[model samples]
Target: MLCFGIILRHILYQKKEAMFWYNFETHNFETHIGWGFLSAFYIASIFALQVI
Candidate 1:
């Protein structure tokens, strides 16, 4: 899972859309769809590991 996440992050980074963050100056959120999906995947994988 970790390896996959790393690879996925790398690809997303190369595409210039890896993670999302708040834009404090604009008082809005910046969208980075890839990170959202990646985060969900990581969370689910961690939960599954804990269950098993």
Candidate 2:
């Protein structure tokens, strides 16, 4: 389970930019919240979790 979680995280981290484009085209939830806050929260969460 832990290994799977780590792999999933690595995949997402590597695909951040590509996912943004996909989301943009799909008109996903971020269209409402905007990327700035999401990025800030993502960064803060990583820092808070001591992941970096």
Candidate 3:
């Protein structure tokens, strides 16, 4: 998970220019909230799969 996070962060950093429109248009709070929701959903799905 730590390696995944590091890779994900690296990819995001590398793709910053590609996402300029999104970054420019969205407020920081909104971006953070979106990421938070995505992370929560990812974690929930992992747990759900484990249960199954």
Return the top candidate by TM-score.
3
Q: Write the per-residue lDDT of candidate 2 for residues 1-52, one digit (tens) a residue.
A: 5566566557656667776887778978855356657666666755655653
Question: lDDT-based ranking, best first?
Answer: 2, 3, 1
Q: What is candidate 3's local distance difference test score? A: 0.60
C-alpha RMSD between model 1 and the true structure: 5.6
Candidate 1: where is the Cα deviation over 4 Å?
A: 1-31
Question: Number of backbone collisions per candidate, in order?
Answer: 0, 0, 0
Worst 10 residues of 1 by lDDT: 17-26
lDDT of 3 by residue, 1-52 (tens): 6556557656755555445556567656677666666656656755665566
TM-score per candidate: 0.42, 0.41, 0.45
Q: In candidate 2, where is summed lDDT lowest over 10 consecutive residues?
A: 43-52
Output the TM-score of candidate 2: 0.41
